[model samples]
Target: MKNTSSDIEEYLVNVPEERKEAFKKLIETISENLPSGFEQGKSSGMIAWQVPLETYPDGYHCTPGSPLPFLNLASQKNFIALYHMGIYADPELLDWFVSEFPKHSSRKLDMGKSCIRFKKVDDIPYELIGELVQKVSPQQWISLYEKLYKK
Candidate 1:
């Protein structure tokens, strides 16, 4: 189910009680370490950090006028999921994250093309996620996105 909150803070307030603290901490970690040029907003009901439309006038091709999405965090029914567009677009980054997962946590990585799922709130590797959040700048993400989009 999608988060229906129009505002980021409201979305936070609505997170299920069991996942509240970890979800908030993960959000805080991303906010603290996210590279410059990204703006925080709500996208498709999830909390998103994106390259602003003003910065990248083309916006998201999938949703005209929307910013170019970088990362999104959602509290799903069973897990907290972080969707990172860069990891989907960049193979090196995906490989790096896969290789690094074991060093950060013992729990097996639960992931999809772009979604990294943390089933146990306490199992989330906040430090590793913080580092992952820093690996891509808005400009870099835009360039990577364009290269893939143009293909």
Candidate 2:
């Protein structure tokens, strides 16, 4: 069954107390590392941090006046996934990810026009991930996005 926002929240709430704490820590780390102005919201059952409307008036759909997400985090039945939006738009970044984190197979990347799916918290390189987040300030990311995804 496709999970919804409520479902995901409920799942997180019911996790073993220990795991729940770990999840919270992970969430906190992500929030702390992300650039300012990235708002968090529930979208399609996942916790997402996205570009503000002013930055991408059209949203993730690349449509005007739509609410879109650039990144998402979710706890699934078996693992957690962190979705990164730049994987598809920034070839250099993607290449860097592959070269720097060679242990992860290409299959781990669920490439969309701008999404990188990472299963399991351990599957990610937290330091590098933080660097990725820091590399493009929120404003810069939005501006680059506008240029790359002009519609």
Candidates in order, TM-scores: namely 0.97, 0.71
Which candidate number would show the highest lDDT if scored against the true structure?
A: 1
What is candidate 1's lDDT per residue for 21-135, written digit by digit as tens?
A: 9999998999999998999998888999999989999999988888989899999988999999989999999999999999999999999999999999989999999999999
TM-score of 1: 0.97
Least accurate stretch of 10 residues (summed lDDT) in model 1? 142-151
Question: Which residue pairs in candidate 1 have backbone atoms (N, alpha carbon, C) closer than 3 angstroms, thus clashing?
Answer: none
- Determine the C-alpha RMSD for candidate 1 after optimal superposition of all C-alphas: 0.9
* Cα lDDT of model 2 by residue, 30-72, tens digit: 7888888888776767777777787656676545565656677
